[model samples]
Target chain A: MRFTILFSISLLLTGSRGFAQQRFVLEQSSISFHSDGVIEDIAATNTNVSSIFDASKGEIAYLLNMKDFQFPKKLMQVHFNEKYVESEKYPRASFEGKIVGFDPAVEGLQQVNAVGRMTIHGVTKDVQFPGTVERKGGMLAMKANFILKLQDYAIKVPQIVWQNIAQQVEVTVDFNYRAQ
Target chain B: MMRRILPFVFLLPLLAHAQGDLLDELNKTKPGTDYTIATFKGTRLVNGHTIETKQAGTLEFIFAHRFGPLDGGVYEMFGLDEAFVRLGLDYGITDNLSVSIGRNSADKIMDSYVKYKALSQRSGQKSFPFTLTALGGVAYSISPRRDDEPEGFETVDRLAYTGQLLLARKFSPRLSLQLMPTFIHKNAVSKTVERNDHVALGVGGRLKLTRSVALTTEYYYRLDPPDNDVLEAQTLSPRYNSLGFGIDIETGGHVFQLVLTNTTSLTERTFITQTQGDFFDGKIHLGFNVTRTFQLKKQERR
Candidate 1:
C-alpha cells in the first residue's frame, strides 16, 4: 500500500511539471498595420497585445483590443474605430494557430509556417503565414508579417472614401514570451 | 486494484493538458472594456449642442449658414436667396476640455465658449450610465445700436452670457438622447416688459438611419416665458422657443448637417431666448453646417 501511494504521488508531480513546461506567457507584444492608398499612406500600431503559446502542442493564440490602435492623425483614428472597424461592436481581433514542427527544446531560431483562423469585425477566415521563432536564454521571441484583404472580413468601405483606404492591409506582429 | 490505480494516474495528465488550453486561458483573462464611440457624430445636433467633442490636440473648422424663412416661396428662391453665415473654430485643449470661438452674421455677434466634460459613460470595470458636460459662453453683439434709441447704448449692454448643463446617454448602438438645462443672462432687454434673465430646458435625440447617416432633432422650451406687452402693443411678433430637426452625414474627416429650424440665429443666447419665428406659423429656415477636423499634434508613443 505504501509503495502504491508513493508511485501515485510521483506520477502527479511529474505530470504537473510537464504541463508547466509546455505553456508560455507573452511578456511583450506589438501588432501594427499599414496600408497604401491612392490619396495617402495610413498606418497604426497597437502595443497592448496578449498572447499565449503551448510549445509541446505547437498551439498559439493572440488577443488584441481594437481600440488600442493609435494613429498619427486623431481624426483618422476616430474614423477607423467608428466607421471602418466598428470597434465598439467587435472590441477584439483574435487569432488561433498551430506552428508547424514547434519544439521548445530547440535552442536557436527556426523558420516555420503557421496555419490559423483569424477573426475580425465578427468574421472569421482560415489563413496561413510564415513566421520565425527563436529560443534564447529561457525566452521565446516570435515574429510574423502577413497581408489581409478587408473585404474577406466583411469590412465595407463607402464609395466616397474608397480612394482613401487600401483594400489590402499589411500586418506585422512581434511577441516576446516567458515560460509560465 | 493495480489496474484501477494505473488508469487514474494516466487520466491526471490528460486533465491537466485539457486545462492548459491556451485559447481558453486567454479568454479567461479579463477582457478589455469598450466605451461607446460617436454617441453623436457632430458637436451640434440641430440648434442645441450635442455631447460630442473633438479629441485632444485636434481642431475643427465649421461653416454654418441659415437662409430666410421658407414662407418667402419662390420669390426668395425658397429662402435660399437670403443667408446668415457663421464661421467658427473649436479646439480641444485636452480630452475632456475644449474651447470654441464663432462669428455670426445675423446680429454680427462674436461668441466664445468653453466646454468641460465632467463624466463619461463606460462599460466593464468602471461603468457609468450617462455622460455629463458643462458649457459656458459669452456673446458680444458687434452690430450698432438702433438709431431710434434715445441714448447711446453702453458696451456692457451688448454682452450676453449663457450656461448649460448637458446630460446624455447612449441607450443602444443606434440611439442616443440628451437633456439640457440652460440659463441666459443679458444686460439689456429689447423691450421694456422683457426680463434680462431667462431659463429653458432643451431635449435632443439622435437615431442612426445607417452606418454613416443619422437623424437628429432638438426642441427648447422656455421655462420663464417673456411677457412683452409693450412690443405686443406695437404689433410686433412675440418670440418663440427654438425647434429644429436635421440629418447628419459623416464622410472621412467631415460631418455635414442639413437642418430646418424656426430660428435664424446660431448662438445659444439668441436661438434659445430671442427667436422670433414660430414653428406653427410655417416660419422655418433651411440651414446647413459643415465641420472639418485637423489633427494639430502628433500622438505620443506609449
Candidate 2:
C-alpha cells in the first residue's frame, strides 16, 4: 500500500499528465477576420466557437462553424459560406496547437508562442502565432492575432470579384476557458 | 519489483491519455444543431422566390427591365426599343418574415407581398431536409379606361390575389432546387370563357459555375388553362408557359442577374398565367434585374 501511495504521489507531482491532468473548456470566444480589398473592406466575426485547453501539457484546440460567421451584409455572409469557404463541404475550421511557454500556475499575463496546424476550406497548414495568455484563479484567457493568405487553404478568389475581396486577411482570436 | 511495478500501474493511465489528441477532446464539447445556410444566394432565382429571407433590419431595392423579344430583329434593334420596367423595395420585418412593394410600368400595376419562412433546412442535432416558405400577394391594375369599358371599372375589378408555398433544398454546394405551388385569383378577365382562378407549379434551379457567378433557370407550368373546349377558336393570346434562364453575378452588396425569358410581364399574377409567347418559337425577351441590399438595422451587433 505504501509503495502504491508513493507512486501515486510521484504521478501527482509530475503534474503534466495522467489522472491529475487539468482540462479547461471554453466559456466564451470570439474569432474575427478582416479582408481589405481594393474596392471594399470586409470584416466578419464568429462568436459561436468551441474550444478546449489542456493546461497541464500546454495543449490547446479550437473549432468554429464557418456558417456562424456574421458579416455586415447578409449577402456577403452567404457568399462567404457558399463560395469562399464552401461551408457545405467544410462546415468547420479548427486549430490544434501547443503554447510553448505558458505556465498555467502563473497568475498574470504572459506572452507565448503558439505553433499549430490550422485547417479551413478542408485544407490544413502549419501556422505559428504569438499570443497572450492570462491565468486568474483557475481561469485561463487567451488572445491571438495573425495574418492568413487566401491561397494558403486553397480558398480561391475568382478574377471577377477580385477587387471586392483581398488575398490576405488578418485574423484575431480571443478565448476564455474555465476548468472542467 | 513491487516499487517498479507500482509506478508502471500509475504510468498506464497516463499512457492511454497521452494517446488521445487535443482536437478529439475539443470535438466532444462541440454543441449540436446547425442550420443550412445559403440554400439560394438571393431572394429570387431567376423570376421567382427561392426560399430566402433577408435577415431583420435589411432592406433590398430591386430594379428589373425587360426588352422586346429577341426575334424582333434588326428593324427593332433586337428589342432594345421596347422596355418594361419594375422597381421594388423589400424589407425584413423579422428574421423569418419580409414584406415587399413594387410597381410594374407595363400595365401600371402595383404589387405587394409578404414572405414567411415557416421552416428552415438544418443539419446536426436537429435537422430538416427542406425549407418551406409561405407567400401571399396582391396585384392591382390602374390603367386608363378603354373604349370597351365606356365607364371606368370598379375598384374590385382591378384587384388580383396570389398565394404560393415555396419549398427548396440545397443538395450540394454547387446545386439547389426550388418548387413553387401557386394559386391566383383575378376579379376580372376580358374573356368570359377564361377561368377567374389560375393554378400553376413553378420549378427553379441554380448551378454554380464560378466563385461569383451562377446559372439559374425557372419554368412555370400552368395547371389550369382557359377552358379549351369553350375558347378553342378565340385567340386572345398565345399564352404559352413561361420559361427563363439567368446568370447571377454577385458583388459585396449587389446582385446583377441577366435573364432571357419568354414573358415580358414581371408580376406573379401575370407571369404565372399570361405568358404570350413560346420559348422555342424564338420569342425570348432579354432582361436584367439589379438588386442592392442595405443594412438598415443590425440583426446581430458585432
Candidate 3:
C-alpha cells in the first residue's frame, strides 16, 4: 500500500511540469503628457511585453521596447514619416528582468516584485517594478508605472526654447500577454 | 474695345464643348471655381463693419479677392461695399516679400506697405509655422481743411507707419487661432498727452465652423487713452480705432461675408485717423465678395 501511494504522488508532480510558465502581453495602450503649460499625447502598440515565470531557470523575465511608439496628427504624421523619429534607424525600446521570490509550484494568484533594465530612445536604465502574477489555465498577467528623463537618453533640449519645455516625463504600462 | 470682343472669343470655345448649352455649364461650375484659394477663407463681415468704414482700412477681406488688386475704385464707392482693400502680392523684386497698396475713403487717404514671412513651421512644435514679419507703410490724406470752414477744426494729414507681429497656431483639425500685436505711428502727433503716436494694441481670431465657414473678430484698443481735449466745432466724435467682427461663409470657390464695425478705414493709417463705426447705433455695413479666377495657360508653338 505504501509503495502504491508513493508512485501516485510522483505521477501528479510530473504531470504539472512546463504548465507553470506564464506569459502576458500588452493588448492596447495610450500615454499622455501635460507639462510646461502644454500638452503632448502619445499612443503605443506591439512594443511592450513581460513574462511572469521562467520554466528553464525558474526566473521571471520582463521586457519592453520603445521604438514602436507612435504619435498621431495628420500633419505630424507626414513629418514623422520623413523627418525625426526615423523609425528605420531606431526601432524599439525594451526591458528585461526577473520577478524575485516567485514560486512555480503555487497554482493560484501570486504577487511579487520584479526588477529589470529598460532601454528607450537608446538609453537603458535599471528599473524595479511591482507586479501581480496568476497561474490559471496556463496564463499570466503583469503591469507597472515608472518615470523617465529625456536627458538620460541623450535627448537634447535647445536653449532657445528650453524654458517652455520640460526635461522629465512619466511612463505607465499595463499588459496582458497570452502564450502561443 | 478689347473687353467687348474678349467675351465672344472666350465664349466660342465653351460653346463648342457644351454643344450649345454654354450658359448651363457655366452656372454648374461657377461656385466651385470661385472659392478655391489655398489657405482657409477668413471671416469677412459685410454688415457695416469697421474694416469697411474706411475705403482704405485693411479688413480680413484678403481671403476674398478685393476689387481685383490695385484698383482703388471711385471714392471707394466700390469699398462702400468693401472699405479697405489691401492687395497682398509683390512689388517689383523681393524674396518671400509681398507688397500691398490700399485706399481708405472714410478718412480720405491712400496707404501702401510690404510684409515678409521670416520663419517657416518646424516639426515637434505647435503654433505659427512662420515667425518675424515686418511691415512699413505710408498714408496720404486727401482732405486737409478749407480756410472758410468752421473754427476749432482738426484736420491732420498724417503719414503713418505700422509694424505688426502675426503668430498663429493650429491647435487641432477644427480649431486654429492667431494673435496680431501691432503698433501704429501717425505723422500728425496727437495734441493730447494721452494719445501719443496713436499707440494701440490689436488682436484677431478665426474660428472655423466647417471646411468653408468661420467666425472672426478683431479688437483694437488705444493704449494711450483718449484725451479730454475735444474739438467743439466737429459734428461727430473723433474716436481712435474701433472694433470689427464678421462671419465668413464659403461655397464652391466664392466667399460671402457679413460685417459689423465702428471703424470705416481699412488701412492701419486710415483706421487710426477715422474710425466712426458704432455697433450700438446699428451703423454696421453688409457686403459679399464674388471672385472669378482665370488660369492663364502658356501657348505652345504649332
Which one is best on lDDT? 1
By descending TM-score, how would the candidates be arranged? 1, 2, 3
lDDT of 3 by residue, A75-175 (tens): 22222322233332343445555667567567666777767676655667887767665655445555555556667866554333324335665665555
Each model's iRMS:
2.9, 3.7, 33.3
In the range B113-229, model 3's lDDT, one tens digit per residue, is: 666545433322233453344555666665554664345544543456777665544444344455555677665653543243555566665666754467777676666545424
Candidate structures ordered by DockQ, highest first: 1, 2, 3
Pick out the ten consecutive residues of candidate 3 chain B with the lowest summed lDDT.
B48-57
Give lDDT tens digits, candidate 1, residues A134-156. Answer: 99856899999999999999999
Query: What stretches of model 3 exceed 4 Å from their correct place?
Result: A1-180, B1-95, B124-132, B145-158, B189-196, B228-236, B251-254, B288-302
lDDT of candidate 1 vs native? Answer: 0.87
Screening candidate 2 with a backbone cut-off below 3 angstroms (N, C-alpha, C), the clashing residue pairs are none
Worst 10 residues of 2 chain B by lDDT: B143-152
TM-score of 3: 0.41
Error of 2 at B253 (Å): 2.1
TM-score of each: 0.92, 0.89, 0.41
Off by over 4 Å in 2: A1-19, A159-162, B1-16, B145-152, B227-235
